[model samples]
Target chain A: MSPLVEFRSVERTYPSRQGPLHVIRDVSFTIERGGILAVVGESGCGKTTTGKIAAGLVDPSRGTVLFDGENISGFKGPELSRFRRRVQLIHQDPYSSLNPVRTVYQTLAAPLKRFRLVKNRTELLHKVRELLLTVDLTPPDDYLYKYPHQLSGGQRQRVAVARALTVNPDFIIADESVSMVDVSIRSSLLNMLLRLNQELGVAFLFITHDLSVARYFSWRGKTAVMYLGRIVEYGPTPEVTRLSAHPYSRALVASLPVSDPRVARLRAQDDEVGSPDVPSIQNIPPGCAFHPRCPLYMAGSCDRDVPELMGMRESESLHQVACPVVLTR
Target chain B: MSIRSDSAPPASVDGATLMSVRDLSVVYRVGNRLVRALSNVSFDVMPGRALALIGESGSGKSTLGSALTRLLPRTAEITSGSITFNGKEGRVQLLDLSSEELRRFRWRDCAVVSQMAMNAFNPVMTIQDHFEDTAAAHGLRDKAKIHDKAYELMETVHLDAKRVLPSYPHQLSGGMRQRVLIALSLLLSPELVILDEPTTALDALSQRAIIKLLRRLRQQLGLTMIFISHDLSLAAELADDVATMYAGQIVEYTDVFSLFDKPKHPYSVGLIGAIPDLSADGASLVSIPGSPPDLVSLPSGCRFHPRCPLSDDKCERELPLLVETEPGQKVACFHWKDAQTLKGSDAFEGRNS
Candidate 1:
C-alpha cells in the first residue's frame, strides 16, 4: 500500500529583502498509515512550515506533496475538502488556539456540524461528549458548557485534541502540541495520542524542538532532524537518538538536561562544535551549514562541498546522515 | 550516596549559610476570598552555593522567589514568616524592612533575574542608557565611572561592550539580551541572585550555554543563587540542593545528587520519572494523575494525596510535615520509602484499578 503522506524532494522559499530565501531545502520523508514521523528542529528551521504543507495549509514552492501517491498540489474542490477533513493541525499554544468566547460544546460541535458527521442536536451533544471522553476530559457534561478560560492549560490542550478528533481525521500535524503544557501533565496527553495512533490508526507528524519528547512520543517511529531548512539526518527514532550520526544531532542529544546530577554535571562542558550562534539562512555557509560548528569539520572539502543525505558506516539500518565526514565513511 | 541530616551539609557545600527562611506563608486577597499562594515554605541558601526551587506552574515557586525579594504584587501579602538574610552589616530581617529601606536593600544586597528579564529592558533606551539608569539609581553618578563599569561587566558576560552599548534591546538576540540582563543584575555585585527560569525562552543550545555561563559566574562571584525552574533535570546541573514544591508547600528538600538518585518524596519521584531521558529507550513517561489542588479550597489533609500513588486514608486526613527522613533529606510523604524502588512505569501502576 502507498504511504499515508509523502514529501517528494519538497522545497519552500519566500521572497525577502536579502533575495529569494530558501526556508526548506530538499526535504523528503513519508508517514505510513497509522505510523508517526517526528520532525525535530529548533526555531526558524522550517519544521512548522513542513507541517503546514502536510496539513494543506501552505503550498510548497517546489516539489510535490503526495497524499497516498496522489499529488496534493493538484487537489481542488471536493478533493481538497476531503483532504482537509482527513488531516488536522494541532497548534502549540492552547491559550491562543482556542476561541475564548465559544463554549467547549460549541468548539467540538462546530467541527462535527461542518463535516456533517452528526445530524441533529442530540447526536451533536452525544458526539461532543464522546470526543471529550476520548481525550480524557472526564464527565463531559461538566466541561461541555465551560469556556476556554474556565479550563487549565492541560484541559485546554485536551479540548484542542478533542476538537481535532471530532471530524475523525486519519492524520494529525501536532506542532509542539504539548510544549506549552506543564511537564507534569504532558505524559497523559502524549499517552492519549499514542492510544489514538494504536486504536484509531491515526498517523502523526509530530513537530518539536525537543528530541527527548520526539523520542518519547514516537519511540517505534521515524525521526528527521532539520537544520537550516534541510533534513540533515533521518532514521528510526532509537537509532537516531541512541547512535546519532549527524554532529548536530549529537550536540542536541548532549545538550539535553538529564535528571541525574552526577551525569548532567559531567556533561556541562561544551559538547558542541564551533560557535553557539546559528547562522542566518540568508547568509548560510557555502558548504555544509553545520560545518562551522562541526567538531569533525575538515578544512578543505567541508568548506567546499555540500553533502547530501546518505547511509553511514555500512549500516543496513534506515539511518541516513548529511555530513561530509559521515557520508565519506 | 548516603542521606545526611538536614543540618549536615553535602560533600560539595563548604560555604556558610547565607540566609534562612522559616514558616513563610503568603496569601492573596482575590476579591473576597483568600488564596493561599504559599504555606509553610522553608528553605536555605548558603554562600557561594545554588538552591533550586523546582515545581510545576502553580506550585508557588515564583511566589517564594517574589516573597524573598519583597516584590509580591499588591494583592499578595506575607501573612507570617521571617526571611533573615546575612549581609556585610550582619543579619537583617528582609520582611520587616520599610519601603524605603527595601529599595535600598534591593539590587545592592539581592537581585532577581526573571523569565521576562530579556523583555524587561526599555525598548527605546540604548544598552548604555540602561546601564547608566541602573547605576545612577544605585547611587553611581559619575558618567565615566559607570561607562567603565558597564564595559567591564559586558566583558565579563562575553559581550562586545562597544557594539552592544550603542544597540537597543530589539537589535540583540535572545541569548545576548539575557546576558545583558545578567550583567545588569550584577552591576551592584549583590551577594544573592535569584534566577527564575532565566533561559526558558531560549533554544536548547543557548539554554545550555546560558546555564554554563551562570554556573561559572555564580562560582567566580561567590554569590548565593536561588535558581527556580520547572525542569528538575536542568536545575540539578546548577544547584547544590533541590527543593521540590507542590501546591504552595515543599514536598522534598535534599542535596541535588541524592534527590535524583533516591528521592524521598512521591511527588519528586513522579516528577523525575516524568522527565524524558535522551539515553534511555523504551521507557514511557509517567505523569502524576489529577491536577493540583485549588489553593482557595484545598484538599482535606495532604494536598497531593488525591493524585499520590501511595496515599491512604491516613494521608487523606493528616497533613504530613516536612520531616528529616534521611540525613540531609527531608520529605513530607508518608510512603516515600515504599515509592523509592518504583521506576518510571511502575510508579503510576495500579492507579486505575
Candidate 2:
C-alpha cells in the first residue's frame, strides 16, 4: 500500500520586510500507513511549519504533499473536507488549544456532530465516551461534564487527543504535544500516542525539540533532524540518535544531558561546537547553515558548496546525512 | 558535607552554610482556600556549591525560589520559617529585614534569575540601559565603570558585547536574552545565585549553550547556586547536590550521583525512571501512576502516599520527617529501604546501564 503521507521537496516561505523568510526548504519525508516520523529540531528550525504543511493547514510555497497517493493541494470540495477529517493537528499548549467554556463532551462531540459521524444525541454521547475511554479518561461520565478549566493539564491534553481521534484521522500531526505536560505524566501521553499508532494503525508526524522524546516515541520508526529549515539528517531512529553522521546531529545528541552524571560529564568533555549562535532565518548562512557552529568545519568547501542529503556508507543503507565532509570520511 | 535534620547543629563541617532555611512554610490564598505551597522545608545552601531543587509542577520548587528572595505574590504568605544568610557583613535574618534592607540584600547579597527571561527585561530599555539602571539602583554612580563591567560580563557570557550592549532585548535571540539575564544577575557579584528553570524556554541547542555557560560561570567564579528545575537531566548535569521535592516538601536530599544511582525516596526513584535517557537501549519509562495532589486539600500524613507504591496504613497515618538515612543522604519516606531495594532490581539497572 502507498504511504499515508508524503512530502516531495516541500518548501514554505513567508514574505517579510527583510526578505522571503525561508521557514522550510527542500524538506522531504514519508510516513507509511501506521508508521511514525519524528522531526526533531530547535525552536526556529521550522518543524512546526513542516507539520502544518503536512496537515494541509498551510500550503507549501513549492513542491507537493501527497496523502494516500493523492496530491493534497489538488483536492477539491468533499475530497478536501475528507482529507481535513482524515488528518488531525494537535497543538502544543493544551491550556489554550481547548476552548475554556466547552466541556469535554461538548469538545469531543462537535467534531462527530459536524462531520455527521453520529446520527442522534445517544450516538454522539456514546461515541464521545468511547473516545474518552480510548484516551484512558476512565469513568467517562465523571469527565464528560468537566470544563477545560476544571480538568488538570494532563486531562486537558488527553481531551485534546480524544478530540483529534473524534474524526478517526488516519494521520495525526502532534506538534510538541507532550512538552507542556509535567514530566511524570509526559511518558503516559507518549505511550497513549504509541498505542494509538500500534492498535489503531494511525500514522504520526511527531515534531519535538527533545531528542530523547523523539527517540523514545519513534524507536521503531524513522527520525529527521531539522536545522535552519532543512533536514540535516534522516534515518532510522536508533542509528540517527546513537551513531549520528551529521556534525549537527552529533552535537545535539552529545550535548543532551543524560540522567547519569558520569555520562553527562563524559559527554561534556567531548569537542564543543565552534559557535552557539543560530543565524536568523532571513540571513541564514550560505552553503552549510551549520558550518559556522560545526566543529569539523572545513574552511573552503563548507562555506562555498551546498550539501545534499546522501547515504553515509557505500552500501544502500537507509541512513542519510546532508554533510559531504562527513560522507567523505 | 554531612546529612542532618532541620534541628541539627549549625554549619561546622564542609565550610560554613551560606544560607540556612529552617522549617519554612508558605501558603497562598485563592478565594477562601489557603493552598500550602511549602511545608516545613529546611535546607542549607553551601557556599561555592550548586544545589538543585528538582521537582515537577506544583512541587513548590519555584515557590521556594520566590520565597528565598521574598518575591512571592500578594496572595502568598510565608507563615513560619527563618531564612538566615551568613554574609560577609554578619549573620542576618532575611525574614526580619526591613524593606530597604531587603532591597539591598536582594541584588547585593543574592540574585535570582527567574524562568521567564523573555519577559524579564524592559522592552523600552536597551541592554546598556538595563545595566546602567541595575548598577544605579545599587548606588553605583560611575556610568563608565558600569558600562565597562557590563561589557566584560557580556563577553564572559560569550556574547559579542560591542553589538549586544547597544541592541534591544528584542534584537537578540532567546539564548542571547537568557545570557543577558545571567550577565545582569552577576552585575552585583552577589554571594549566591538562584536560577529557576534557567533553560526551560530555550531550544535544545540553546539550552546546551546556557548549560555550558552556567557550568563555566560556576567554575570560574566559584559561584554558590541553587538551581531550580523539573528536568532531572539538567539537575544531574549541573548540581553537586540534589533535593527532590514532592507535594511541597523535600522528600530526598543527597549528592547528584547518589540521587541518580541509588535514590532512596520512592518519588525520586519514579522521577528518575520516568526520564527518557538517550544512551539507554529502548527502555520502557515508568511514570508515577497518579498526578500530584492539590495543595489545598492534601493527602493524609505523608503527602506522597496517595501515589506511592510502597504506601501502607503507617504511611497514611503518620507524616515522615526528613531524616538522614545514610552519610550525606536524607530521605523523608518510611519505605526508603524498599525503594533502595527496588532500585537494585534488574529493571532499573537495565535502564541505568
Candidate 3:
C-alpha cells in the first residue's frame, strides 16, 4: 500500500529582491498511514513552509507533494477541493487562525456543510459535537454558540483541532498548533492528538520548536531534525532525542533546561544555533550550512563536502545522521 | 554573588509594605455582559525585591501588570482596590493619579518592559533618541549628559553601543531589539520595573542574553521588579520569589529554591512536571489535564480545582485564599497538606501523562 504522505526530493523557494530564496532543500521522506512524524528546526528553517506544502496550500518550486502515491502538486479545482477534504492544516494561533466574527457552530458547520459529512441540522449538530468530543471538548453545547474570543487560549486551540477533524481528513499538518496556548493546557491538546492518531488513524506532521512537546507527547512518532532547510537526522523519537546523532540535534536537546541544577550544570552548552541563518533559499553555502556552529566540525570535510544521510556502522534502525562526526562516535 | 535561601529564608514581608494593592480587580464590558479580566487579585512588590507572577495566558498576568502601571484601555475599569506607590513619589495611589501624573510616574517611577520590543520603540527614531525623549520628558535638560548616559546604558545591557545607537528597531534582530528596549527602560532608572514575558519572542541565544543582562542590571542597580512569564524554569532562574498565578489569582508562591526544590501547591507541582528535563532520561512530561479557567464565569470554588489532581469537595465549595504555606511562601489551595503527601512518590516520577 502507498504511504499516507510522500515528498520525493521536494524543494521549495521564494523570489526575493536579491535572488530566489531557497526555503526547503531536496527533502524526501515518507509517513505511513496513521503515523506521526515530527519536523524540528529553528526559526526560518523552512519547517512551516514544509507544513504548508503538505497541506496543499502551496506548490513546490522544484518537486511535488504526493498523497497516497498520487502527485498532488498540479491538482486544481475539484481535485484540490477533494485533496482539501483529505488533508487539512491547523495553525499555531487558534484565535487568529479562526474567524472571530463566526460562532463555533458556523466554524465547524462550514466544513460539514461543504463536505456533506452530516445529513441534516440535527445530524450536523451531532457531528460537530462528536468532533469536539474526540478532541475532549465535551458537551459541545457549552461552546458551539461562543465566539473565538470567548474561549481561553487552550480552548481555542481545542476548537482549532476540532475544526481540522471536521472534514474527516486522513492527514494533518499541525503547524506549531499548541505553541501559543497556555503551557498548562498544552498537554491536553497533545492527548487529543494521541487519541486522534490511535482512534482515527490520521497521520500528523507535527512542526514545532519546543523540543519537549515534540518528544512524543502527542503520539510516539518518528522525528526529523531540519537545519538550513535540510533534513539532518531522522529516527525513532526515543533515539532522536535520547541518543542524538547529529551535533545539531545534540545541541538542541541540550538547550532545554532541566530541573536539577547539578546535571544541568554538567550538560554541554549549545554551540550557538549558528545565528539561525540558513543564508536564504538562494544563498546557502555549497557545503554544510551548520558548519559555523557545529562543535565537532572538521573544517576541511564539513565545509568542503556535505555528508550524505548515512547510518552508524552497526545500528540496524534507520537512525541516519548527516555529519562527519559519526566516524568518531 | 548568589544569595542562598539555605541558612534561613528571608523575613516575612508584612502587610506594612512599600507598595500595596488592595482589592484590585479589572473588568471590561465586552458586550452587554461584563468580562472580569482580573477578579479580586492582589499582590505586593516590595522595595529591592522581585515577584515572579507565573501563569499561562488569560491567567490575568499581563492584565495585573497593566493595572499596576495604569496602562490598560479606557474601557477597562479598576472596579475595586487601590495600588498605592509609596516610594520617592510618596503616598500616591496609582488609580487616583491623573494622566499627567501617571505619565510622569509611568516610566520614571514604574516602567513596564513589555514582551514585544518593537511596540516599545519608535521605529523612525534612533535608539539614542528614545532614551533622550524619556530623559528630556523627566526634566533632564542636559542633552550631552543624557547621550552619555544612553551610551553607558548600552554597554551596561550588553549591546554594542556604536552599532545599536544609530540603528532603527528593524535593523536589529529580535534579541537585539529586546536588549535595546531593556536599555531604554533603564534610561530613567525606574524604581519598579515590571516585565511581561520579556524573552518570549526571542530565540534561545537572545533569550539567554536578555536574561543574563536583566540579572546583571538587577544586581548592579538594586531595582525592585515584578517579572511575569509562563515558563517556570526561566522564571526559576531569575526571580527571588515565584508566585504561580491562575484565573487572576496567586495560586502558589514561594522562593525559587523552595518552589523548585519543594513545590507545595499541586498546580506548581504539575507545572514542574510539564517541563522536559533534558538530563534525566529525557522522560516524557506529565502535563496538567485541563486548561486555565474562564475568568468571566469561573467555577464555584477553586479556579484550578478542575485540573488539580488532589482536588476534593472542599476545593469545589470554598474559594481558596492566598494563605501562608512555609515562611515567605503562600499557596491558595484547600488540600495543600494532602497534596504535599501525594507529591513525594509520583510528583517527580514519570513525566508521561
Candidate 4:
C-alpha cells in the first residue's frame, strides 16, 4: 500500500533581507499508514516548515507533498476539503489555538457540523461527547459546557485533541503538541496520542525539538533528525537515539540531561555536545552545515561537498545517516 | 552536603551556609481569600553550591525564587519564618529589613534573573542605559566605570560589546537577551544568584549554550545559585542539591545525586518516572495521576495525597512532616519505603486511569 504521506525531495525558501532564505532543502521522508514519524531538531531547522508542508498549509517552493499517490498541492475544492479533513494539525499552544468564548461543546461540535458528520442536535451532542471520551476527557458532562478558561492547561490540550479528532483524520501533524503542556501531564497527552495511533491506526508526523520525547512517543516508529534544513539521520527511533550515526545526531542525544545525575554529570563534563550558533538560513555553510561544530569533522571533504544520506556499514537495520566520514568508516 | 533533620544545627560548623531559610511561609491575598503560596519551605544555600527547586506549575517554585530576592508583588506577604544571610559583614535578617535597606540589599547581596529575560528590559532603553542605571542605583555614578564594567560583562557572556551596547532589548535575540540578563545579575558579584527558568523560552541549542555559560559563570565566580526549574533532568545537570516541591510545601530535599538515584518521596519518584528516558526507548511514562491540590482549600492531610499512589488513611488525615529517612535524604511520604521497592508497573498500575 502507498504511504499515508510522502515528501519527495521537498525544498522551501522565502525572500528575505539577506537573500532567499532556504528554510528547508532537499528533504524527503514517508509516513506509512498507522506509523509515526518523529522529526526532531532544534529551532530554525525547518522541522516546523516540513510539518506545514505535509499539512498543505505552506506550499513548498520545489518538490511535492503527496497524500497517498496524489500531490497534496494539486487537491482543489472537494478534494482539498477531503484532504483537510483527512489530515489534521495539532498546534503547540492550547491557550491560543482554542477560542476563549466557545464552549467545549461548540468547539467540537463546529467541526462535526461543518463536515456534516452528524445530522441533528442530539447526534451532535452525542458525537461531541464521544470525541471528548476518545481523548480521555471522561464523563464528558463535566467539561461539555465549560469555557476554555474554566479548564486547566492539560484539559485545554485534550479539548484541542478532541477538536482535531472530530473530523476522524487518518494522519496527524502534531507540531510540538505536548511541548506547551506541563511536564507532569505531558505523558498523559502523549499516551492519548499513542492510544489513538494504536486503536485508530492513525499515522503521525510528530515534530519536536526534544529527542527524548521523540524517542518515547514514537517508540515503534521511525525518527528523522533535521539540521539546518536537511535530514542528517533517519532510522528507527531507538537506534537513532542510542547509536546515532551523524555527528549532529550524536551531539543532540548527548546534550539530553539524563535523569540519573551520575550519567548527567559525566555528560556535562564531556565537551563534545551541541552545535555552535546555528548559521542563519541566508548564509548556510557550504558542504555539511554541521561541520563547524562536529567533533570528527573532516577538514577537506566535509567542508567541500554535502553528503547524501547513506546506510551505515555492517548494520542490518535500515538506519541512514548523512555524514561522509561515517559513511566512509 | 548530607541532608539533616529540621532540628539539625541551624548553621554549618564551618560557617559555609551562605543563606539559611527556616520555616519560610508566604501567603497571597487573592481578592478576599488567602492563598497559601508557600508552607514551611526551608533550605540552605552553601557558599558556592547550587540548590535546585524542581516542581510543576503552581508548586511555589517560582514563588520561592521571588521570595528569596524580596521581589514578591503587593498581593503576597511573608507571614512567618526567617531568612538569614551570612554576609561578609555579619548575619542579616532579610525579612526584617526595611524597604530602603532592601533597595540597598537587593542586587548587592542577592540578585535574580527572572524568566522571560526579554520582557525584563525596557523596550525604549538601550542595553548600555540599563547597565548604567543599575550601576547608578548601586552608587557607581561614574559613566566611565559603568561603561568599563558593562563591557567586561558583555565579554564574560560572549556578546559583542560594541554591537550589543547600543542595541535595544528587541534588537538582540532571545539567547543574547538572556545572556545580558545573566550578566546584569552578576554585575554586583552577589554571593547568591536566583535563576528562575532562565532558558524556558529559548530553543534547544540556545538553551544548551546559556546553561553552559551559567555553569561556567558559577565556577569562575564561585557563585551560590538557586536554579528554579520544572525540568528534573536540567535540575540534575545544574544543581548540587534538589528540593522537590508540591502544592505549597517541600516534599523532598537531598543532594542531587541521592535524589535522582534513591528518590524517597512519591512525588519525586512520579516526577522522575514522568520524564521520557532516552536510554529506554518507548518506555511507558508514569505521570502522577491527579492534578495538584487547591492551595486555598487544601486536602485534609498531605497536600500531595490526592495524587500520591502510596497514600493511605494516615496520609489522608495527618500532614507528613519532613524526616531524614536516610543520612542524605529527607522525605515526607508516609510509605516511601514501599514506593521505593515497588517497581514501575506495580506503582503506576491503575494510577493513570
Give the alpha carbon lDDT tens digit for every residue of A70-147 in model 4: 998989999999999999999999999999999999999998988899999999999988888898777788889999
Off by over 4 Å in 3: A74-82, A100-103, A118-125, A144-149, A259-286, A294-308, A325-329, B1-23, B29-32, B40-42, B46-48, B79-104, B219-223, B279-291, B306-313, B341-353
Model 4 chain A: ten consecutive residues of lowest lDDT: A268-277
DockQ of 3: 0.37
Clashing pairs in 4: none
* Predictions: Cα RMSD each: 4.1, 3.5, 5.5, 3.5
Question: Evaluated on chain B only, what are the TM-scores of all the candidate structures, in order?
Answer: 0.93, 0.94, 0.90, 0.94
Residue-level lDDT of model 3, residues A61-115, one tens digit each, is: 8876789888997778998889889998889888799899998889999989988
- Docking class for model 2 is medium
Compute the TM-score of each model's chain A versus the native chain A and list the values. 0.98, 0.98, 0.93, 0.97
- Model 2 lDDT per residue over B1-353, tens place: 11224454334322488999887889999999989989888888888999999999999999999999899999998887778899787888888999899999998899999899978999989999999999988899799999999999999999999999999989999889999999999999999999999999887778888998999999999999999999998988899999999989999999999998889998888788788887556767776655788888888889988777678899999889999988878999998888965542133322210
TM-score of chain B of 3: 0.90
Candidate 4 residue spans exceeding 4 A from truth: A268-275, A299-301, B1-16, B124-128, B143-155, B158-168
DockQ of 4: 0.60
Best by lDDT: 2
Candidate number that wins on DockQ, 1 or 4: 1
Q: lDDT scores for all predictions?
A: 0.86, 0.88, 0.77, 0.85
User: Tens-digit lDDT track for model 4 on B1-353?
Assistant: 11224443444423668898877888999998988888887777888899999988889998888988788999999877778888775788888889998998888988999898878999999999999999889998899988999999999998999999999998787888999999899888888888999878886667778878988987899898999998998887788999999998889999998887888888888788888867666678876665676777888788887777777799889888888887757888888787676447337546532
State the TM-score of candidate 1 restricted to chain B.
Answer: 0.93
True contacts kept of 3: 0.40
The predicted structure with the larger DockQ, 1 or 2, is 2
Candidate 2, A215-310: lDDT as tens digits: 999999999999999999998898999888898898888777688987786674554677666788889999999999888899999988889999
- List ranges where model 2 is wrong by over 4 Å: B1-15, B341-353
